[model samples]
Target chain A: MKNIVIIGGGTGGTVVANRLANRLYDQKDISITLFAPEKNHIYQPDLLFLSLDLSDPRRMFRDEQKLLNKKVNLIQQPVDAINVDNKFVISKGKKYAYDYLVIATGARLVPDLIPGLAGNNNHFYDYSSAMQLRDKLRGFKKGVIVTGVADVPYKCPPAPLEFTLLLDYKLRKYGLRSSVDLTYIYPINSIFTIQNVVPILQKEYDTRNIAYKTFFIVDHVDPEKHEVVAMDGETVKYDLLVLIPPHRGQQIISDAGIGDEGGWMSVDKYTLQEKNHEEIYGIGDATNLPVSKAGSVAHFQSGVIANNISNSVLGIDEKINYDGSTMCMTEIGYDKGLILLFDYSHPPYGLIPSRLNHLAKVFYLDYYFANMMYGLP
Target chain B: MSDEKVTKVIDARGSYCPGPLMKLIENVRLAKVGDVLDLLSSDSGTKKDAPNWIKKTGQELIGIYDEEGYTRIRIKKIK
Candidate 1:
């Protein structure tokens, strides 16, 4: 039997596993397995809502095994090393052999990469940290509440903007809009990375009286001064700081010598396959695709990878490629959101933030489980 | 109408955003140079996105037509 192994049980890995299982079920010679370190599959986008007191933590996760196809042997263990040359993976002191490998290991937040940023953890990229930020936001009445990104290539490109706008609405709900001084800082010269979406947010921030400081790279945070020091010797004081930390792929990928210094695996942008190894496919945040490291991107890439791999397994010579299709739901607040979509060849059109988009996002909480994870059309 | 013969017809009526485009791309990759292609998509975004993709790839656009509950996009593989 040919073994198809998928690592990292996140969106891409799960979708690939499910799609492959569904497509190759009747084929007697093929078997599928998924290696996941975590028992729970998190709906990470909900972390945005969870941190703002807008969603329940209970809705954020599902058991990883339940989400997988029964045909897929779910091995809940952290992968220690990848022996690509020998075509095997080392997990829990045991090596598992595979005929094909899919890397959807995803990205990890390196909060401690920035000194003084890894405290009680005030970021929403993960579950516990989001809850911690939620409590802090709940207690604060008025003072400088700083929300910013520490680096580029972070997952969910629009999240910092989403959080800043949603925080404005949160303050408005608390009847402390005028009392709180909210500021958004970005490492880049612009407030956001995407040029097309920046104007809409710039106008929104101006209308909301939300101040933003650009080119403010974080140097360190001084708890005694209640301020964050920038690389340029500027300080911004804050009562509460929510920072999106620097992110990198799994270290095992780098240690295996198949990834970049940042640990992100290199792939042919169109094929989603490792540059030199066609047997290995990389998807999701782990890939160095010039696109947003969001779930929708993974959802789109899943189809390409799954289709191509299944085609190969079935002895078909035809193959398809991914076009960097990515769509992100930018929630301005509980009531307003917008959809940003683009591919490798197209830039995003102008955005119109609306409640309809917000409702779609709210609806997606259900749709994600019903369709996305199952790799359904 | 031009005398060029059709090369392939792809029905991607139920797929969501970029699915139809992806189908077109797959077929485009498979088609020989100068081959004619058509795609049927229910996703309205394809109406706008497909032409732009064709333009970027230097492929020839035949036309996009409306059909019963779907849109038809025609193209010719250039290079």
Candidate 2:
């Protein structure tokens, strides 16, 4: 039997596993196994809405076992290492052999990477941060609230912008807009990494009276002073500082000596296959692809890898490719939503935020987000 | 999908993601209301995203044909 071992229980891993199982439903000669460190899988995109006090915290997660197909064996264990040459993985000193391996160990928020930021990351990229941020927003009635992205190459480039916009919306609805001074901070000259997105965000920020500091890199956070120190000795004091901390790949990848300095595994851009290792593949934030490391990008690549692996197993000569597809559905407050879609060859230019886009973005969580674990697009 | 008259055939096989979708939209804007546009792409994301785009734009997605090496998506411009 052809054994397929997948690591991580996040969007990429769950989707890839279910998609592969659904693709090869009738095939009995293959066994698919997924390794996860958690019993419940959190829908990460919900964290954004969660921070804004928009979504039910309970609905943001589903049991990992319930999210997978019966065909996939779920092992809720921490993977210790990946033996590429031996075609096996070790977990708890136990060996699991595989004919093909999938690395979907998504990026982790390393708050300690930024000085004075550990235990002070009020930003909502994870569960605890979302909850803490929601609580903080409740008690916050005045003073400056700064939302920014501290590091580059973080997953979901639009999130920091989304947080700023959505927070503005929430404060307005709560009658606290006048009391709160909202500012956005970015390391680059533009508010967004994608050039086309800047004008749109800039227009919105201007209209909302949202101030921003461009080229202000975060040097450290001064919790005692409630201030954020920038690289150029500039300081921005805030009653509440919400920022996206730096991110890195899983430690196992680095320990295995298979990942880059940032712990991101290298892969063929088109095929999503691990470089120099034909039997291994990568998806989502763990990969060093130039694509945006959002769930939509992972969602798109999951199908490509699944289809390609299915074809490889069935002895079909067919091939499909991932084109660095990135779909970012971000809400720009006032019940408006922005949709950004681009690939390696083309950039999103004509797209704009609309009420329909906002509705669709929220609707995704109501239905598609949960159904997606079952391989639903 | 049908023996319908094809007003334009856009070969966007090597194009990625929104490339094919953008090409479809560009041609759709110029074509007559009844014109049918054929978009060919090897990128899988368009195969899924194009249908949503068509539905949102109130256009007709004729069908998605999985050809040997590429995908053929047919669209009808409706004003």
**lDDT, candidate 1, A248-341, per-residue tens:** 7889999888886568888887898998888999999998655678999888998998899999989999889898788888988759888888
- Candidate 2 C-alpha lDDT tens digits along A1-377: 99999999888898899999999889999999999889988878789999888989997778889878888899999899998888999999999999999999999888786799887658888898789999988899999998998765587878999999999988999999999999898865568766667788899999999999875667799899888987557888888889998887888887877876668887887998887888899999897665677888888999899999999999999989998788888889889988888887787754677999999887787565566656766
Complex DockQ per candidate: 0.02, 0.02
lDDT of each: 0.82, 0.83
Per-candidate TM-score against the hidden true structure:
0.81, 0.81
TM-score of 2: 0.81
Q: What TM-score would you give candidate 1 relative to the actual structure?
A: 0.81
Task: Supply the global lDDT for candidate 1.
Answer: 0.82
Off by over 4 Å in 1: B1-79
